[model samples]
Target: MSAVMISRKVRKWEKLPGKNTFCCDGRVMMARQKGVFYLTLFLIIGTCALFFGFECPYLAVHLSAAIPVFAAVLFLFVMAMLLRTSFSDPGVLPRALPEEATFIEMEIEAANGNVPSGQRPPPRIRNIEINNQIVKLKYCYTCKIFRPPRASHCSICDNCVDRFDHHCPWVGNCVGKRNYRYFYLFTLSLSLLTIYIFTFDIVHVVMRSVEDGFLSALKETPGTVLEVLVCFFTLWSVVGLTGFHTYLISLNQTTNEDIKGSWSGKNRVQNPYSHKNIFKNCCEVLCGPAYPSVLDRRGLMHEDSPVSASSAAPSSSSSSLSFSNNSKPAPPTTKTTAPLIPNEHTPDDAKASIGVSAEQSCSPEDLPPSFIPPLASPETDAEASVAKDNSH
Candidate 1:
């Protein structure tokens, strides 16, 4: 029976639409293909080499000697930060433990009505108190565990990341808790580098124009114009990203939270992590006081007793039951002994019979009274009886 049940479940899972096997290697490959990581890298190197080595020398003969060296140093720093952000772990959650099994068992028991009515667990979807404020934590079905507040599942990475910021295509990685600092640094450095290059190109053009005639300088240093345009276009995006991140850091909010409207209005005050002081918030994100490792079932950061969805079985069961009641009808039953029934049924007659059977089988106390339809009136019953007699 158990084997059959397992096989049935496996078949059901296999039949589920849009269910695809998540391969880490495949995900990485996809990210590489979609992201502008290589394209951006090439642009950085090619533009710098062309502008600093060739164009700068032609435009500013005297200052050309120092330009290459400065450009090289800045480019290297930007690359370093980019690489660091890409390779660093984004704080993946650990696998389920044996203790979690117990929690699951408890929830099952509660759902099955083994537990007392008064002791029934609270609903899982309801908010939990964390640091004297109510917070709603979400469960990740893919991970088979609850995610911490600010944590999210990245579709590209196919993993739940702690303090998830965003999946940055430029970096070719998810900008999450562990790597956000490096990602920010990379953006800031890239913006500065672009501005520096833009300034150099502008200086070269201006200086050349002053020394030579305007048309002569433009005609001779065509590469300077290209460099200036490239720098100007790239700088807009890079600087804008840096500025946005700076604002996020000051507010102590992630891109996901900002976009999803999670920390708006009343929720802003309830968020325990935010200090409301801009300086303090920025320090927390950039300087790093470090978030707590441990969390309760509620997903609150603490060193208290470990709790999971299974740990608070009653609540989980109640939530599950509530969901089931809302979404579906009661289970069908089969018995060897057959009950007598009329051969024909009108639409209303069939509905009334089914409702009567459901009410008889499921008690009013066990399920909501709404599930059971009211009995047929005496007039209707008399009509049904008279029709039956007439047919006989």
Candidate 2:
């Protein structure tokens, strides 16, 4: 008896094509990028201090120190979330080879008379119908498996991510199932921080301007003007991102799915994945389940669903059958029918039926018909034939 091996472990990122060496140096590169991100954060903080503290000393000294403290704390929280998002596993699917092998073994046993022939399993079916519409689960040829609904292959990361959001160039990672919460938190916190900074900078400018004339204050506090402008410009993008994510969380949809127009198709009003309760959706996204559940291709959540031969064998066969059916060409149509005009019709009647006048056949308008090639006259053909015979 052949032993069945099952790999419960999710596919590793480094094992993906063109990533063999990335595994060795990926951490180093990631660390470097993360350092760069941290440096950027510090630069923003330094800019805020330089403008707010040095340029507007009067406003800085008089204002409650607690404002800067609060902003610092918020910034740190955003940093933490950003780090989490960058490092967290993005819900990779397990490679199908092990499961596929087990299915093959079962089929072989049945064929060899080890199992009753009547009990032979149905072929594996990958495409399934949902809401009266046939929906094909996305199969990653690289991963060699059918990914769950809402999951997508990220070409950049070279991995299929579950509940795939979008790959953030800033974070230098794919924002997906395990890290989506962190990404959302980071966006929300960053938006709040920008808003706070913008407000604080505006207040500082106004307070200093009131003490001195507006032009003198502007000259004296150039840093404050810079900080205010920077924050004001950055505020809208951060706020918009936060708002968009908040809406997505409420609907239990991912950025990828929303952009792909997956939600509005047949499942528009009746999206099974969404709990339909905003509060529930938020809790599910933010807090997550106490026990992790495996999401099937249909997006159905299952806890401790044992992988038995009985269950696995049928799906494997079905998938193979589906592949075969899709690969095979459609049967040619055998039924031949007579033309609209019967062959027994006279040439004049045929011309009349075709709505073409004999006079128009040789007309200049029809001389250059795009589809028809020019034909040589009988005289030209006879001359060519006679010339060929004489040459012979």
Candidate 3:
């Protein structure tokens, strides 16, 4: 096997001080806000239910019916929230930003080598265009290298994410490498919860009418109209939400990723994530063997040193990066004592570099000077001030 000469072209991005961290903070804030909304909704609903239940003669029956329904709703809601948190990543990996564009150009130079075993023919290089613009990207100071294919910058964590997933506001996290599974589960559970509540409330409404002398129920109870209408609306909402999410799940796509259509390079391809049979996919995702790979599980910051991809290039080997121009590299950075290209066809350099430089590049200093604390105003005695002024 021979060494592959990989080059990158990076274009300077707008240096906005606040924009970089805004997404990260925005996600966290959004989650907190959502939590607040859920808490408020729960309280309002419970209070309303209690007040109404006590007023009507048939209220007790309705209330009893709501108990299990409420329990299931709550369980699903909680599960959804948990899934969101789990899937939301901390944005530790290297990704390309709109302003800080980077293009990875790999030129394979085989040394005394035939095609490495298990190595498929290298993917044919094509000019990748986004938004009809021929991309001219540059090295990211944060990632300390060129961005890989299908990579995007996460503003919140101030790093590039591979196979760029969207940042999730609901979980106060980015749905990237580490937490994508959790995010998926969250969506599933949330859909279930909504559906459960919609059904339970419908049943509760029906039971109340039945108990209240079914024929005259609507005529006697003025509130019944409103209650029925509200329940129907909720049902409508649930149906729409469930249906849309179901489609997304079947395609193995995220809400954020799907909303932006026909633009992402990866999405342009027949979505590889969506092609699997739903039942088998679900089984593998939950209990079977098709769980997301280890690389798919953790955020960049949390990843242990040495990046690995099951589908990564065969010549990819484990290598550690010890230093970067922006910051000090990790200690005990492994040397290439072994052949630089391992039999496994792994990239030792890419693996080690992925973890080391990406983690170190995001320094507080990288933020704008305005974000840095100002030094205390230099103090001077009156005499010193007068002398300085006189000299001037």
For model 3, what is the error of residue 143's alpha carbon versus the real structure, in angstroms, after optimal superposition? 3.9
Give TM per candidate: 0.59, 0.57, 0.40
Which rank order by TM-score, best down to worst? 1, 2, 3
Clash pairs, model 2 backbone: 123-317, 123-318, 124-317, 124-318, 124-319, 125-318, 125-319
Model 3: how large is the Cα RMSD against the reference?
27.7
Off by over 4 Å in 3: 1-91, 94-142, 148-150, 213-242, 253-392
Candidate 1, 229-305: lDDT as tens digits = 88889999999999999998988999998898776765455556788899999888999954432312122222222
Best prediction by TM-score: 1
**What does candidate 1 score on TM?**
0.59
Worst 10 residues of 2 by lDDT: 293-302
- Model 3 vs. true fold: TM: 0.40
**lDDT against the true structure, each candidate:** 0.68, 0.65, 0.48
- lDDT tens readout by residue for model 3, 137-168: 43455654455544566665455655456764
Model 1, C-alpha of 126: deviation from truth (Å): 6.9
- C-alpha positional error of residue 289 in candidate 3 after TM-score superposition, expressed in Å: 8.0
